[model samples]
Target: MKLLLRLATSLLLWIIMMVILVLIILLPRDMEVKRIGVKDHMSYHFTWSGYKENIQQYLADVKENKTLGTSVAHQPVEWELAHYGKRSIAILVPALIISFLIGILKGVFDYRRNRGLWKVLGEGTTWLGQSIPDFFIIIILELIISLTIHRMFPHLQLYGIEHWYNIFLPILFLSMYPAAVIANYTTQALKEEDDQDYIRTARAKGLPETIILWKHVLRNCWSKILIHFMPIILTLLSSMVIVEYMTLYRGMGTRLMEAIKIKDTIASTDTILPIETPTVIGFSLEFMIILLLAQWVNQVIKHFLIPVRKDEHT
Candidate 1:
């Protein structure tokens, strides 16, 4: 019931945000372009009729499968949605899975080893990874791969998602920061769990360190780990814009940029009204759903991990 309420609230919030975004986009802007035999002409107005007309036209285009007639491209909004939706999923799913696994494994290793070169390298790498901006990482990695590896293997293109291998670099770029964040939190959570009385009791019982850490400590630390997951997801979502743009992946982020650039133009001049509304709404929905899912997952994990106490009845 609570989850349902939360979901409803999130959906409502997303709708509100989308409405505001659309209004901002639809609001007229003062044009400063020089017209022959005319002084500066500033025209800016907000009208309900315009907003309604725009919405109706967008819906009509979608229903009739009509091309949006964008200044740069003549493609139906449906095609754009389907194409970018698939690419976004392709990038998001694999990057998330790989990052989560790497983070958990790195966290476990960091907790187990007291002193070693592996620890030194892992700590240094994660710290560096967390500190650097994702775009810089993407640029540096692209340069290194293009110069050295691509010379030996010309099949791998530096930009554009032409093949399956093309996604590798972008995914790596997206995953690095989140993975490092997760690993850092995981290590801290486990270290804190290590000093708890339950851990001490397990150690005193002569249980193997591996079993105790994995079966007991790690199980207890899941709730704590999940608490930090939402921020990691938000980070990944934001980073996708840069990564997709840099790699020319033709995803939602790229579409969003195009939409923003042409938001103020007239439909006759640039017919992106249909494309802009759906793109903005689609991205907003995706973001809200992911956020809600993260919250739900965290709540489920926390509920399961928490101890349920029985009340004594006289």
Candidate 2:
């Protein structure tokens, strides 16, 4: 009965998320850019047909605007759609998976013993990392690299590393912030779990520290950790915005920023709206899977260490 309820809840969440995704993708992109009435005077906008014609023509020109002097090539509407659809999926899906795995494992290790000092240190480190503005870090790093290269090797082209370094910088920046947060929260959770009576009782039973920490404490805490940390996996999509922009890497973030600043409706919408579909779907599925797996792991651990009737009563 509990398992059935869990499955139903999961289905409901998935349905709600899917509905939101569809609305975002289907909503009128031009609404954000359209001029509304001013305070002094009421203004009438163009008819829907006229607006469509203008926007269509603008989108057409966007593709051919080679002289715009941007780093990225201007893509046609279809190309932009296809490119971003694939890119969002390709980047976010695996990133969420890998980051979650790392976070869960690291969290297990950090929280196993539930040491208070370690928990405080972990939380403090994440808070520090999160407080630093992404752009500030980017600028500082960029200047340091550029200046260091200029002083050491005058012949080096702008920086010491090759162009590939630019690629790695954004990925590293995106990964680091989330990892810090994950480690911090995991540590705190573990520390809290260690204070529980069950953990103390396990130790009292002469269980080895390793088995008590991992087999008992970590297993019980998995559900709480999963619920609390689910959003961490999804946040990478937003983090990429700052990381990619600061590094001047040609990722979706750069393109999206340009689209918004220029008020290019199609470009902006294409980047933000449908592009998120795959990321949403993948993240949703992954989160659900993790929840189930965590719950299953929790149950298995509870079953072996203690009797079912005891667990139920507790």
Candidate 3:
């Protein structure tokens, strides 16, 4: 009953959040005609009202072998949809899963061994990650990287993001914040679970350390870690804006920034499209799927922690 109530509460909060996201995205931007072109080249005027029409015009011009001042219209409808959809999942969803799994596993182990220091480390690490802004970390890392590169190869100047090293630094920095938060919460929850009377009872039974750690400590601490991860995923999604802006990576973050800068309504709307639906389904099916998985995990843990009795027990 408690689990169900918690699930219901989580669902309600998710719905509220989705509604807010929808309102922010759907509110029409002020339309204005602006010239858009590549690399500070010649351009043509288009407004939000005529966005589709302009795309069509560009496509038609290309089909008829016409050029608008060195620009050829190649509307990337299929590419944009496919790319953005894949990227939204690739960046946010997988990161959440990885962080939760690794954090929970290591955290439970650490808590079982070092109850005293784990508390301080867990809380302190999370607080440090949360209190410091992500951009500040990014800038500091960027400066360090810049100095290193200049020292090693003075002739080499990094411009485009074609280099593998260029891509990794930003992703690593952005990911650090969430990973720290997950580890912190996981450790704290496990420490708390370790102090429970049930754990003491299990220990009194002379269970091996490994068995107690996995079956008792981890199983009980999981739900708390999961709950922490849910909001961190949301925070990471929000932080993508800053991360992409700073790193200049061509992910959804960068795409969203580009739309805002150019005032491209279609692109901006497309970028903000929820993982599941944009205008059709009111509920976020993508987020709903995640919520369901979290609930299923909770049920599995509960069942394991408290076994049901058979009729023979009577």
Candidate 4:
């Protein structure tokens, strides 16, 4: 019941947010900014008497199957959004899954054997990962590839994402810092769970360390870790955007970069032209949907975790 309530609350919030986003995007810019070329067709913004009219027109567009309107590039916003969104997900989902697995295991290993060289390495790696900007990490990877791997392979293409595996590098770079955060959070949660009287009793019974760690310690710590899942996913989204833009991965980030580019006729002019309001809004709406999907997935995971927790003793 509580979980359902949380889902309901989140759904309500998402709807409110999307509505506000649409208003902001469709809101009129200064009439002074010159609308040119394909932009002349963007008559919706050039003339807006009131929000009610705009909302009604938007609904009409929906009914007429012109939902996404158009883009500055003179292409359908819906088609472009789907293309880039697909690219973004192709890289993002794999990276996120890899990071989660690596992070959880590393965190467990770090805390369970918290002594000597292994401890120092795990702590240092996580700290450095959080400290370093993802851009530099990608740059360093690029430099290494050019310096060594490309030279060694002679004709092999490592960048520009020609094949599915071409994005392997981007995925690795994207996974790094989010994994570090998860490791740190997991380690802390485990630490707190470790000190509990229940853990102490379990240890007192001469239970195998492996069993105590997995069956007892982790079962309790999971709820704490689950609480951080959304934040970690947010981190992944931000980093993936940066990585995609830098690497020119032809993903949503690249599309976003293109959408935001200033199309001003005079570079010195203070007037800010609308790059593609519909495109921008389309991009934003899709991104919001991704987050909504992530939230739903997290709730589902929690539902599954509940059963696992109950069955732990069995």
Candidate 5:
């Protein structure tokens, strides 16, 4: 019931945020006109009706099996969607999997072993990973890999989806921050759990350290680690913009740049472009959906944690 309420509240907030963003994007702009007598006349006006009309038209186009709209490059929205979906899946899935595994392992290790060179190395690596900007990492990796590896295999593509290997750099760059954050949070949560009476009792029973660490400490800390890592979705999204743009991956971020360029061009020319509305709204919807999904995942993990923690106490 609590999970349901939280989900409901999150959905409501997401909707409200979307509505606000749409309103801001649809706000009026100043325009200049020339008349017979007046050399130059300036007017500022809202085009609510036009915005509504464009949305209706776009929906009708979809029903009739037409394009969503044209992008700045004159490509249909359908094309952009296909490419964006592909890149998003390719980058996000592998990154998430790798980050979660690495984080969990490092965290568990850090929790069980207090004094070691490995612990110091792990801590230092995560701190450095969290501190460095993703874009800089992407660039450095590209340069080093291209110079060394590309020379041996000139056929490998760095930026496009022509081959599966193209995604490696972006995924590696995107996963670093989240993995570091997860490891840090997991270690902290486990450290806090270390002083609890239950942990003390578990220790008193002379259980194997490995078993106690995994079955007791980690089980309790998992949900909190997930909660702390939820915001990594936003980080991934932001990183995608730079990663995709720099790599020319033709993903949603690249499409967004195209849309932004189109909007800017139209504004400068005093031309009201209907295509910009759908383009902007489409990206906004994608972001909101991702955020809601992250929240739902967090809530689900939290709900499961309640039962597990209760069992531990019992």
Candidate 6:
């Protein structure tokens, strides 16, 4: 019954996401450029024509299995999605790993200092940071760099987008909320476990704090802790898209945005390409698949661990 419910819920969420993506692609506030004079440009109010054309073109392409129209060269929609998806995976996987490590370690660190200082410093800091949304994090960091750091050291060398070191800032930024969430959960989980008879007995037996944490409290509480990773995966994945788009990183998000944006393909003829529907749908669907897979993995872990939890209690 629970399995059926979970499946149904997931399917519903997936459908809703697909609907939203299609709307964003098909029902946009469309616009075109007009010349006020030779060099000046004016924005024209949009019409339903742009929307109609996008849907018609998109359907025709789907029927014919046509190539994506956004790129300069002829490229299959599948190829564009695959290429950019791989690039996103390369950057995001590292961010995911780093986020997990930071969250787990920081959580453990906070758990160890669970009294006095932990309440004021650990709890306050973790919850506060976690409350702020992902986009704000990126904006805050960008502002810090632009307003303060860039002004302070006007000639300081900064890494370009493609530079290896450029990956670190996004990774670090992405790691923040996940880490804070994990840390917060870890502290609470450890606290709950600390009140257990086994943990109390171990403490009464004069065992060192480290041994009790690693061997006893954790052993009993690890299954519960595993559940937290489920949400963190989603958080990290979504944040990867946002961060990549905001920074114009060469990833799936950037590709999708670029395709959706209105651009003049030919200045001579003033030819405009409509939103790359195939490319947009392709990337959005690919991202949804990855998200579904992560959710499936999380469910699998819970499914396996539930029996162990029952046995332990029995």
lDDT of 6 by residue, 72-152 (tens): 346877888888788777767777777667766677777776589776676777778889887887788888888887899
Model with the higher TM-score, candidate 2 or 3: 3
Q: Per-residue CA lDDT of candidate 3, range 97-198, in tens?
A: 656665665565455545477755645556676688878877888798788987899866443355745545445655777876777787787666656676
lDDT of each structure? 0.70, 0.54, 0.56, 0.78, 0.73, 0.71
Tens digits of per-residue lDDT, candidate 2, 207-244, equal 99888877777676555555544466447766766765
Model 6's lDDT to the true fold? 0.71
Model 4 clash count equals: 0
Any runs in candidate 3 off by more than 4 Å, and if so which?
A: 1-73, 84-89, 105-122, 153-167, 208-211, 262-314
lDDT of 2: 0.54
Which 10 consecutive positions of candidate 4 have the poorest summed lDDT? 38-47
Per-residue alpha-carbon lDDT of candidate 4 for residues 1-314, written as tens digits (9 for 90 to 100): 87888888888899899989988776655434334765532222455575567678777876797567777667788989888888888889888888888888888987876788887888778778778987888788889888998899988775666876778877888898888888888898888775667777888999988998898788777877776778878898888778887776888877887886765453422343556777887898888988987897788778768677655544
Top model number, TM-score: 4
- List candidate 6 stretches off by more than 4 Å: 1-60, 66-73, 134-160, 262-273
In terms of lDDT, the poorest run of 10 residues in model 3 is 274-283
Per-candidate clashes come to 0, 1, 0, 0, 0, 1
Which wins on TM-score, candidate 3 or candidate 5? 5
Q: After superposition, how far is residue 261 of candidate 3 from its true place, in Å?
A: 2.5
In candidate 1, what are the lDDT values of residues 1-314, reduced to their tens digit? 76567667766776687567655554434233333464443344556787677677765765675543233355555566667778887888888888888898888877776477877877777778789887888888888888898899787675787777777777888888888888888888888765777777889999999898888888777777777666777888888889899888878778777765544544342233333445555555555666667766665654555442111110
lDDT of 4: 0.78
Cα shift from native, residue 266, model 1 (Å): 12
Name the weakest run of 10 consecutive residues (lDDT summed) in model 1: 305-314
- Name the better of 3 and 6 by TM-score: 6
- Could you give candidate 5's per-residue lDDT for residues 1-314 as a string of tens digits? 88889999989998999877766665544464434474444455667786676456656866786655666667776666666867776888788878888887877766666667876777777777779887777778889988988898897677776776778877877787778877788788888786788778888999987788888778887777777656777777878778777776777777767765633333343544434655766676776788788888877877877677667656
Stretches of candidate 4 off by over 4 Å are 31-60, 72-74, 264-272, 299-314
What TM-score does structure 5 among the candidates reach? 0.81
TM-score of each: 0.79, 0.54, 0.57, 0.83, 0.81, 0.73
Clashing pairs in 4: none
